[model samples]
Target: MAALRKKPRSPFWFACFTLPDGRRVQRSTKETTRKAAQAKADGWEKLSKERAKARQAHRVIADIYKSAHNKELPDATPRAFITAWLTRRQGELAPASYAAYSGRATHFLSWLEAAADGPMADLETRHFTAYRDALAARVSASTANHGIKLLRVILEDARRDNFIADNPAKDCGLLKQETDTARRPFTLVELRSLMGAADEEWRSMLMFGLYTGQRLGDLARLTWANVDLQAGEIHLRTAKTKRFIRVPICTPLMEHIEGLPAGDDPKAPLHPRAATSKQVTVSRQFGELMAVAGLRAAVNHDASKKGRGSRRAVSELSFHSLRHTATSMMKNAGVSPAVVQDIIGHDSAEMNAQYTHIESKTKRDALDKMPNLLKP
Candidate 1:
């Protein structure tokens, strides 16, 4: 049974409940309204009852196991379980993906140590909610959502393994993400400006990006063997999508590639620094270059903000804009949608739609095809 009542010194309602084992508990509902307070009290009561049921179920299972095997079952802390799971699954995930999952799991365990005094079995939905809020406050909503999704997967695994009765993070909703309007295709003027401002190596990289319609990572890892200068084709398998594509080298890109010094090593990366540096570091370096070209504003980081590091204004342009630029340029040139999609290795028509931006001249030309109905 549970009841909601306000304490003498508190403004919010408190839920007073008793477990099936005769243990009593009192927790703040944090609801000022009576109806909300009652709902919170009911939820607490339900959770307490469920936990009691789970304890009984566990005890029965343990007794059976002990009678059959003459040994007690092993239990693990949340931290220990997550560590073991990641170790077993690391080889199954991509290197970058494994790193991201490991990082998020580490952060969650650290937060758990500071916030909760109980083991994995005692974690509730409310704890996950609090963690979600903390992450949202520290980072962008998209990042918080990503962390929440990873946490859900981890907890869901725990439930599947029978370590926890239920996954606390399963019901934790993701934050709403703002539409990405910052990334846009670079205009011809901006492209020319960037190319002029870039050094020889950067200029070659930019040319490759425009011609091949590939990501920075893919372009950076390009080897001399992938570029067939005589055949006028650049062959690559996209890292993210694993889609193999062959693109023709346009006249400008061909000229740029021919001018570059050809090293003896066929396996040498086209852009050494880009291949070695982390993707984020490479993006930041390109952002700085864009700032130098006056195409983007300079990023400023606030030093005094604790936990929240470097608040920089989002830029409308990035190295990824080159991919958009390639798609748009092809569409505007009257290339077929299928051809553009194949060149860019787009998996879906919806994704291709995002890249296509019709020019005003093309729209006008389309409109001109419609005859005036009122003409005599």
Candidate 2:
């Protein structure tokens, strides 16, 4: 099923073989010796014929290479591969983003358990599919979808690096969340109640959420240097999008910032507790505030024993509602969709499917039109 052909101009022998798909192809053996070149050709054809019957097709590749050249191909465990991938990616990703990636990957590995310690080349679609289904049974659909998507990205790198021949997750579709609850922006009445229930620090964070229209993680990580009281604006690069945005500080936010004590170090976080705490911790604290304001029910640890068979309850509102609240108010105030996205950091696909690059003056005017939640 294979033969060696020598080209008049080339120094190497060419292996002509038929692929498993019944198509004939030629590959440069890169060896001038007829004996070595034929071995390589024979290996390629054997791999194609035997790969379909093997669970570890990558291992089959290693076997053929060993027999042909007597050289071992490199390999890694899933845990080792994922860990190395995360380390390499740390320089390119933000702190929150890296943490999120690391956390989801932990769940992925934990799901794999004993199997994760085995060779990464041994991985199959069934392993990932089982993890996805298992995760879907335990967590919310949104969370399950995000986990699988992140796994796909991680494994995609593995494929590019020759860890695997194919990506299993590439074809594994997301779960259909028929029961997904739609998130709505906070009403002014609800904002007033939450404000009344919040402490000084939380109140400040909420104000930033309403005014800047940034995510909680970004707002929580804000520092004094990010705020320019003199310039009447806040400057910070969002963690997720990494977009450097300058949002005009409105009346209420400006008032609140002026009242707070300034820190000598520019890097000193604005909300000390929130900045140092995990996102889930800050989110829990906000949930408590919402409980006090009669916005949501308080969690009962005893009631939380609902196992993997039950899906986590979806809330119509959370701290994220503040982000929606900010966007809603901005759009309601006659600010264009582009201006809203400029503030909210939404992709054009999420908005009017159009983007207009707006100047700071145009953005300032848009913020000025938004309702002042502190007054009346």
Candidate 3:
């Protein structure tokens, strides 16, 4: 019979069972005897008919996954999967992201080394829970949360590649973050103090940030090509916002830009430009400068007020506040909301004239009111 075909070289017997629906299924029963082939074929034929009937019965998910009991699965480890994932994603990730992912993967490798089992196939919630708790105990909640976040991403990739049936970290809870109540806008009085305390370079940076509402990231990368000295405007496309922004360089910013050493080669950066080649350093240096200036840190809503509130004793201020200070200052100066959003690279749904709340006349008037440190 065709169901008991003789193998050319293999000792095992192969059987082909054609179902009532005409679908053929192949099975190899290690037994060399024809009797065993017939027995195996009969059992397979029965199973095939049952599966066919079930398919006809239920149409939603037809033969999506076979029962795990019937399939020979490879033993995959989280470490192996993550290594493969990083290799695959290396080109797609940004430089900073590549560094961060590499660091997280290294940390995971260190932890995996101590495990008795070779790879992470059935990582349980308790394992993640203990890791999370250990991380929390060792570092800040935010830092610990980041480790879990990276792990979750790695596991998600593993799931997609069929390394695992489901992601174990899917529902693992992360530490809750308090609302970002960091000091963004400095009140008028505080702004004055900060401005007063700033030196030449810091002063130029502060004035530029306050007047343009540009993030330090954008500010650090600003170039003469981006500035239209003739048009009296600074034109830039923000990297983060991906929005076109044009802000009047105004007298303060223009003068500072003009006075800046016209680039060592007129092609070099406007300022030294984030020495660490990082946006974080731009803001970090700004903070250090502020501390030197004896400017008191501004109070944030989330910080412990038991020892804060006074500018001298406050612990909540970041260089980012300058952007908010500019936006708020513009609003206070009556530059219509739409124009403020436009100048700050913020998106607006309303593009129509009727919805155009901010008029150029208002921006001119508001710009006139803005204080320019270069003046006098």
Q: Which candidate ranks first by TM-score, i.e. highest? A: 2
Candidate 3 segments exceeding 4 Å error: 1-76, 94-118, 134-147, 179-181, 192-199, 263-266, 273-276, 294-315, 348-365, 374-376
TM-score of each: 0.71, 0.76, 0.63
Model with the higher TM-score, candidate 1 or 2: 2
Candidate 1 residues 83-170, lDDT tens each?
A: 8889988988876678788999898889988433234566667777888888877676777889988989988998888877778788
Global CA lDDT of candidate 3, please?
A: 0.64
Q: Can you tell me which runs of candidate 2 are displaced by over 4 Å? A: 1-57, 60-74, 307-310, 347-361
Please say which candidate is ahead in lDDT: 2 or 3.
Answer: 2
TM-score comparison, 2 vs 3, better candidate: 2
Error of 3 at 338 (Å): 1.4
Clashes of each: 0, 0, 1
Worst lDDT run of 10 residues, candidate 2, spans 48-57
Q: Write the per-residue lDDT of candidate 2 for residues 89-132, one digit (tens) a residue.
A: 99988877788899999878887889777656677677777888
Mind giving the per-residue lDDT tens digits that candidate 3 earns over 302-365? Answer: 4654222222232356677777777777778776777777667777566434464454445555
Candidates sorted on TM-score, descending: 2, 1, 3
**Judged by lDDT, which candidate is best?**
2
